[model samples]
Target: MKAAIFKGPGAVEVGERPEPVIQEPTDAVVRVVLGCVCGSDLWYFRGESPHAAGSIGHEFIGIVEQAGANVRSVRLGDLVVAPFIYSDMTCPHCRNGSTISCPAGGSFGNGTIDGGQGQAVRVPQAGGTLVRVPGSGHSDEVLRSLLALSDVMSTGQHAAVMAGVKEGDTVAVVGDGAVGLCAVLAARRLGAERVIALSRNPARQKVASEFGATDIIEARGDEAVQAVLELTGGTGADAALECVGTGQSIATAAAIARPGSVIGIVGVPHGEVPFTGTFFRNIGWRGGPAPARVYIPGLLDDVLDGTINPGLVFDYETDLDHIADAYRAMDERRAIKSLVRVGGI
Candidate 1:
């Protein structure tokens, strides 16, 4: 077997590794068909995320090669999508629709959770964590879109939901990365009348439009704030989403949110949130680790029915042998998202 191992910061190598096997009654082994690089994965690659030499990847779609004795929702030959985090699905947190924070769920890789960026990987709590793809043969578009359900798409959807976006509401999204772009689409799917995206990248701006954004602000800080306000007729957006995990992005989200409006932040914040004036303005904040596992089922139906094509975010694709290039393309912003085809399902 072959997997991409993180050697250190700014480094990754494709090397031979032992294949995974079912280790728990609730576990299942998957033969990875397609995987993609995530924005969060960059943190580990840049030495910003806490990790060591280990399998790297979380968002993936694959075929079930084997299932544990207790697994029932999925079986051999079923194509499924695995969320970045694994949960037992019966825990209180999972039952309440917060599977990502499931008291029993843990992250993949890092020697605790099995990482998915490889030829094959083991998934725990398979019955609850893996969503079976509905059909047998899927086009590239369907496959890629289904793969997005594993993480970025669901994360984006969670961001919008947290922000309280409603029908006819004006929604502004900060950041135009894969997650951010997906947020733009999610806002539309959720019935937002006007979607405002803050991004200077022309490539991303184009995609934002396709995803239903009515406006694109190519500025940041005060200038960006004014742009969003101008679009909202002197008022800020009714809801705003912060998809970038940085101090500046958070500030911008807060600045562009209408007084008493909500700002849903999904970015893994590494810095302190500036709460100055937030309380006095009556602004509300809601967001945390996106429970992607909870949203996969409904989102999958949309993908299968052609209601949405979030896979448009993937502008680059390659096989596992060129996995390092996939990381560099994303790191350099040359690609909105990169998909790696490890094998066929």
Candidate 2:
């Protein structure tokens, strides 16, 4: 089989690799149907978080080729979606609906297990980690949309949920990346009356509008704060969803939020949250790596039922052999997200 190997920063190649096999009774060997490069994957691509040569990918939707004896929830030929993080659903955190907090869980493409950017992957905790992709067969668009349930959509939804978006509330989303756009959609879906998106690109601003952003702020810092305050009648947003992890973005979120509001840091934080400023303003903080495992099921239903079409975020599509190009497209901001057909499905 051929798989993507992260040899070093800025170097990902498709090369021959060993086929996956069931390594545990809770495992399932899945023949990947679709996989995609994540924004977080850029951390490895840029050498920010270095990794020795190994298979690398995390978001995937596939068909179960085989399952071990202990895997009871999924079976042969079942189309499944594997969240970015894998977990045993029976663990205390999982049972309580916090799968990412599961003590028995780990990442999908941390290199010990087969990564999703390949022909097949060995899924640990298969019964708990795999969510059946709904239909026996699905159209390409439907499948693409369902793929978002694995991570992007789940994380966006997590940001909104953690920020405490409520009906009639004004919500501001920081960042214009795919996750931020998805956060806008998630906020609207959760009933926020007005979603203010901080976007600089016209294209992304259009997408944000489609996803329910009633207003778009194109400035940063104090100008951006004034924009939000002006939009909300000088009160500021009821909650702010911080989708970018930079120190500046974090401060922007805090600045645009109303007093007594929560700022959800959905983006993987790259710097320390400014404490003195946030503390003095009485702005609450929450959100981290999303518990995608717990959020996938309901989001899957929304995808299948046509309530949301997050696949629109995937602006470029390619095959496994062109995985490097997919990575480059995302790295260069040429694509909001790239979707790859793993086994030509």
| RMSD, every candidate, angstroms | 1.1, 1.2
Cα lDDT, model 2, residue 66: 90
What is the TM-score of each predicted model, taking all chains together? Answer: 0.98, 0.97
Clashing pairs in 2: none
Candidate 2 segments exceeding 4 Å error: none
lDDT of 2 by residue, 1-345 (tens): 989888889999998889898889999999999999999999889988876578989999999999999999998999999999999999889998788888878887777877889899999899999998756657788898888878888889999999999999999999888899999999998999999999889888988998889998899888998899999999888989999899889888988889889898888888778878878889989998888888888888888888888887898989999999999999999989999998744
Shift in Å, residue 209, candidate 1: 0.8
Local lDDT at 45 for model 2: 96
List candidate 1 stretches off by more than 4 Å: none
Q: What does candidate 1's lDDT look like per residue over 49-87, in tens digits?
A: 778787888888999999999999998999999988889
Compute the lDDT of residue 69 as modeled in candidate 1: 96
10 residues in a row with least lDDT, candidate 2: 132-141
lDDT of each: 0.89, 0.89
On lDDT, the candidate that comes out on top is 1
Shift in Å, residue 285, candidate 2: 0.9
Candidate 1 lDDT for residue 63: 95
